[model samples]
Target: MRHRPATYLEAEEVRAILARPNPATVEGGRDYALLLFLYNTGARVSEAADLCWSDLQLTAPRLVCLHGKGRKDRLLPLWRDTVAALHRLRMNAQPDRQPHVFLNRRGEALSRDGIAYILRRHVQGATQALPTLDRKRITPHVLRHSCAVALLQSGTDITVIRDYLGHASIATTGRYLSTNLQTKRDALETFWQHAGIRPVRAKAWKPTPNLLAFLDSL
Candidate 1:
């Protein structure tokens, strides 16, 4: 049996989800930053949960080293907004620092469930505003799929997305290629453009011989 196609948030849904925080909440910044980081990095929930401060390199060329399945490591570049979010979530002035980049309210490392809860809360809040979000279950895999789909839609080469997602095989990354509507639209548009152009050809001409006379002579 064929499996369902992967689902991803549209660019607008991403914007609405990130617009969740209000000033009254102390943890608002932290929560917003965490979700943005998750979406931007396309890191797995476990990968994000296991992320330590030591794994980040937020310099001129901001990037993160995500430890994905099979203990394999892959590096991905970060957007400026994501880098800024991590910057805003700077560690507390406490003497002993929490090893993880993201932490619970109690200053402990964030678990996968903790991160998922945060994502769910934000997605739920956005649901009232965007009813479309209600129809789907937004999980970490969905966020990961969103990342790949976003890159594909933006015209990033497939091989690059494969490396970015750290897939064991290029075929796994190729799932995005098979189902992207934008890709099909682009292909169809190109076909239409080519079809509109007619090739140079010889002009139509009347027959040189007289058909009735030729037949009678034969």
Candidate 2:
């Protein structure tokens, strides 16, 4: 059996991927917006594709994630741009549009692989440019990692990232933070600044009887 490849995208690679022009056809802008949404929210491919029109608060600034892994549910705030993108997609959709957030050319929901293919089409070139990325293949999971890393770089707490990603363990979400060099450097320096060093001393002073008696009286 073929093993699933690891997914992680660096900050610069995500920027390059997002910089591409949206396709001129069906669900193009919405798809591009989905990529940005995942990069910002760290949502899984299925989670983003499974999102429903009703899942979003059309008149508000938030979205509900109902189809998370294990049927777990959560709410993720949407940026104005992300909300606008969803609006565009919703406007273009047919009157009896399906609930799925992402649709194929036939107006059917996109599978996980379909979403992966969409992302790869835009990200392959960007991935190839990176000297560290030898595979030249990019996927939705990479966008998820990019989101987590970006948040960590911005000083988001580990516990928060864990909650946002809906991880069962904080350790799972912690791996993303480990790749952020700047965060690690800042953490190290902060620790050094607050840690005062003292030499081991030979003094073993004991309280005098008079001092003890005075203390007892007080």
Candidate 3:
């Protein structure tokens, strides 16, 4: 079978992973939380890794991405659970680095590759423990796909998902839409049902002189 991206992690799997004792420390756990946050949010690895403290605001429960693909900036809303994870992370974070949202042990910003490495390790650990998910490998980008798929699966609008993911084109976000087989079937059934009920009838009456006059006037 062809290897494809892991679109969604079943709710039970998600629970299992989250239920596991976080193996990383205060700083490291914060990084891990941020990684999960990014994965859950469908944020680009770079955008999440370079995020600053000021970029996140609890008021709107959102994060402002400064540098996105094509150097564009966009605002991303956080899910309630994602926000909770962030709060927990911030509480244990070191005081030396109040600037960066994700900091290394040295209190410096984490590199994009560093974040990817963290995700790789985390997935490896999570999969090793969960033998049931051995065939379903996860990665940073896969997490991104999972976020989009989760939204699409939950009956979210495709345009909204596109905007949330900061996608420049709707086509870029369509991949997530493809995984929603139930949504597609529902749409097709609705279309056929509506088509069956709506009868196409031709106009039987001839145009009156007044109608002709109106058309002439126009």
True lDDT of residue 14, candidate 1: 69
Q: Give Cα-based local distance difference scores for all models.
A: 0.63, 0.58, 0.55
Model 1 residue pairs with clashes = none
Per-residue lDDT of model 3, residues 1-218, tens digit only: 33332344543445445444363557556744675576455677777777776777655524444467776665554544556667777776553545777776677788787777766565566676677656776556655665554454445666565556666432325455344333433432332232211332322323344433322221
Model 2, 189: alpha-carbon shift in Å? 25
Best TM-score among the predictions, by candidate number: 1
lDDT tens readout by residue for model 2, 150-192: 4444445655555666664223244553443234334323322
Candidate 1 at residue 180, lDDT?
37
TM-score of 1: 0.72
lDDT of 1 by residue, 1-218 (tens): 33344566666676677788652354787787777777676688888888887787878656777888777776666666677777777644132567787788898888888988888898999988999999888976677766655555555555555556666432335466344323433432332222211222223322223322221221
Q: Output the TM-score of candidate 3.
A: 0.64
Candidate 3: residue 148 lDDT (0-100): 56
Cα deviation at 75, candidate 2, in Å, is: 0.5
Which portions of model 1 show Cα errors greater than 4 Å? 23-26, 91-96, 168-218
- My TM-score estimates for the predictions, one after another, are 0.72, 0.67, 0.64
